[model samples]
Target chain A: MLKFTCPYCGIEASETELAAGGEAHLKRYGPGSSEQDFEGYLFLRKNPKGVHLERWRHVMGCGKWFLAARHTATLEVFGTYSAQTHEPPAEIIENIRAKFPEWQA
Target chain B: MSDPRSAVGGAVYEGYVTVKDSGAHGMITLRGDHAELAEAVKAAVGSGMPTQRRIEGGLGGGAAWASPDELLLFCDYADAAGALEKARKSLEGNHFLVADVSDARAVFALEGSGIRDLLAKLCPADLSPEALPHGEFRRSHLGQVAAAFWLESEETATVICFRSVAPYVYDLLSEAVKGGPIGIF
Candidate 1:
């Protein structure tokens, strides 16, 4: 029953209308990299209990992909941003830091 | 040339709400810079570019914001090729993609006093007047299929979905209409 505000279309979409894309912001390691780096890039995930950043596709809404920062345990969303960026916006990072001072990116 | 046929062969159903196939609309999927696309769209459809998640114009011809960089431009079925040609010609020398997708989609017109209530049964979008006012287009799912809809007025809406799912969507709408209004609106 989770709901997300689509950053692209500005619609509050229910979970049923979206598709989860696992964790976000991993530095992709390609063919030239070491096996360990590639494996980590493909399989390793933070799976953090709190303050998680994930990718979501508004499949049914705007059909655009976006990144969301939220607390895993509380399901409190910090913010959503365009998927084209390499990292979360500074404002969202600042907001998360304000709420969880000890948390690190 | 063979006459174009719609997916549902122009089906119609009447219950608490009326659902009918809006046969053979010309749809163009345009992808590029919004500002540039706007000018090309005007040339193709003679309608202004739609704002985010909104549709500008009517069932005859118009543009709907499909995404930040994409638009769904629709016009008369016979004019699809001409419209696509116009858009491409206008966007020449620019990085853009335009295609005539008229046959790939199916459109349905829903009309009744219970339009909102009937749509709410299948779509997760907020169909309230304030949220989905006239001209505001919403790209959402109907039941489990990808669908988009826009309200033409308080009791009228136009829906579009993949042509492959036309029969499925028609059935869904017909069944929902038969369920009678929940009176939520």
Candidate 2:
């Protein structure tokens, strides 16, 4: 079972206490956008085998949502950050870059 | 005026630990900037504002941090209205929301040496002495419902959950303690 430290509450919560929210940093394509962009936004997702970012909610703890970066294959967690930001924080990006030199943000 | 009634009607259960309804407790859900809330909380409950995941005073009259921008203030059930009024008046010009939620919630007292073991069975939080020491407040799931709890001392804890789920939560606690101490703690 995966354990994640909630960035908001500073508690290490198990997978049972959290609700996964698919991918993170998703850019919504609203009205006036092309059908292709909307389709990609709604259905397409990056299935990287390496470092990936995802959104998780501490449903049983502080009930706050946060973002986490981890390796999909190795299950090595890079870091967790507040959900208020649109992109990963500089520190998390640096941490990920340090481990996976060829990985792009 | 009508007398207030607790959600469980003062239910009590005896097993490895004692589970009893703590009766009606005044609770207010306060949400806003913490800086503005500090003054409001002090004015309402005569206690300092709580830090992250902590309670500032005793359960009789204290403030517990519920979230980044929210606090759960406790007081006497009879004084809920007055306390809420004071909080609102103190935060009149600030962007804040405060409400008396005493009737909307249920409180239970768990007493015994197996308090941690009983709670550890239901909650995902680390209930060890070092992790959830006295005065530390935790909001998490108890069984399937959302619940919040804090240690009153080495052997006592106060747990609160929605009034609608009082029976469910009470049963969960009562059953969890029926088999005697787990001795994991």
Candidate 3:
């Protein structure tokens, strides 16, 4: 069982509590998209080791959006934020604030 | 068993709903003398909660210390009822509430790479080990299933809920795995 911290719920999700995301962010267009586009999105993929940004749609609780960055080697999640508002978590605030204080606002 | 009310989704939440008119497992709700029940449960289940929040990054099945007197135990779906009965019969009439819930709820586990990233999308809790850590359990909604989840590590979680709503819960999770937003039912 894995413990997952939901950026939206602000609580730890027991391995039984949450569903896992795809390899980072792999987005596929709806049926409206042409076959080539769908096939390209599904088959072509990249495996990142560090600072990879991905989208995870929480289907269980708050029903919100999130972006997550984690270290593939250490399993250390750098930070997560609500994608709906683009509000990053505090853990990321300090890391980015030092570089761009103006962006903090 | 493919009962009309139960689901053994590939993982815990993958197929969240299960129903059993006759339970294959036993449930023992130990109240009051929660301490004694916990001790017995410890002996029955594998062991107690893990010492470190992050162990090997693969979160294990789930054993937790809820309240001072309350501890929730998880076992094989088939073994749950028997385990509960064993505990109940062992301490008969002891000041505890032991009831067989083997048929009442469905159990599932969600584990894999990017688990935290997936959870951050559904829950509003701190799932990070540094923050929420391990050895914890919370009753919250996973798209309205009103689930109970235990965080074992960075890539594992256990989810259990009423058998009646197992399909909806499983559906929510399935939809998410496909990269769709969760919805309330």
Candidate 4:
């Protein structure tokens, strides 16, 4: 089981204690946006194999939602941060860049 | 109107480990910065936020740190409503959320030499004295259900779960205590 550190509770919660909330930092394409943009917002996803950001809720624990930056292939969690912000933290991006020179966040 | 009965009827199962429904206790979920709510929290529960994952108890009952910004306060049912109101009033004008969850969950008290062993079967927590000493709290899953449990002492633990599944929690505990070679004896 993949263990996730909850940013709010400061606990390394087990997978059962968390709920996956799909990809993070998705821009909403509401009314007035192109149909293509709206459809992409509704259905599109970036299922990258490495260095991914995800939204997870510590439902069984603190009942708070947070974001995590992880390597999908290795399951190595770079870091976790509060969900109140719209973008990933700079340090998280830097860590990813140091490990993966080819990718950009 | 009649007083409410415990969700598990206060059942007591005698085994290597004894599991008892502690009955309906007053449980409140409070969220705010401890630095900002320190005085108000102390006034409400006789204490402030507990030291991370620890529980503190006094005349007003116990308070456990639920998260960095949240605390769970527990007390006798008779004093719950008044304490909540006073706490709310104390923190008036502050950005906070205080919710009374007394009816939302049930408390089960277990004590005995084998209590820790029993927990090993149900939860993934370490449960060792060094890993989870007295007054430690953790929110985890018990089998398939969500539960919040704490080590009140070396030989005692208090588990809180959603009231709707109190029976399930009780049954799971009972089964664990009465099924194995180390348990049923």
Q: What DockQ does candidate 1 score?
A: 0.85
Q: What stretches of model 4 exceed 4 Å from their correct place?
A: A97-99, B58-60, B181-185
Binned by DockQ into CAPRI classes (incorrect, acceptable, medium, high), candidate 2 is medium
- Candidate 3 on B38-137: residue-level lDDT in tens? 4555554544432222111121223443333444555566566566766666667677765656677776666665555555565555555555555455
CA-lDDT, candidates in order? 0.91, 0.90, 0.53, 0.83
Task: Residues B30-88, candidate 4: write the lDDT tens digits.
Answer: 88987776766677777756887778883237788887889888778777887799789
Clashing pairs in 2: none
Return the top candidate by lDDT. Answer: 1
Cα DockQ of the candidate 4 complex: 0.59
Query: Candidate 1, residue B51: CA error in Å?
Result: 1.3
The Cα error of candidate 2 at residue A36, in Å, is 1.2
* Higher-TM-score candidate of 1 and 3: 1
Ranking by DockQ: 1, 2, 4, 3
Interface RMSD of each: 0.9, 1.2, 9.5, 1.4
Q: Which scores higher on DockQ, 2 or 3?
A: 2
| Model 1 regions lying over 4 Å from their true place | none
10 residues in a row with least lDDT, candidate 4 chain B: B176-185
Q: True contacts preserved, each candidate? A: 0.87, 0.63, 0.10, 0.60
Worst 10 residues of 2 chain A by lDDT: A1-10
Off by over 4 Å in 2: none
Residue A74, candidate 3: Cα error in Å is 42
Could you estimate the TM-score for every candidate? 0.96, 0.95, 0.48, 0.89
Clashes (candidate 2)? 0
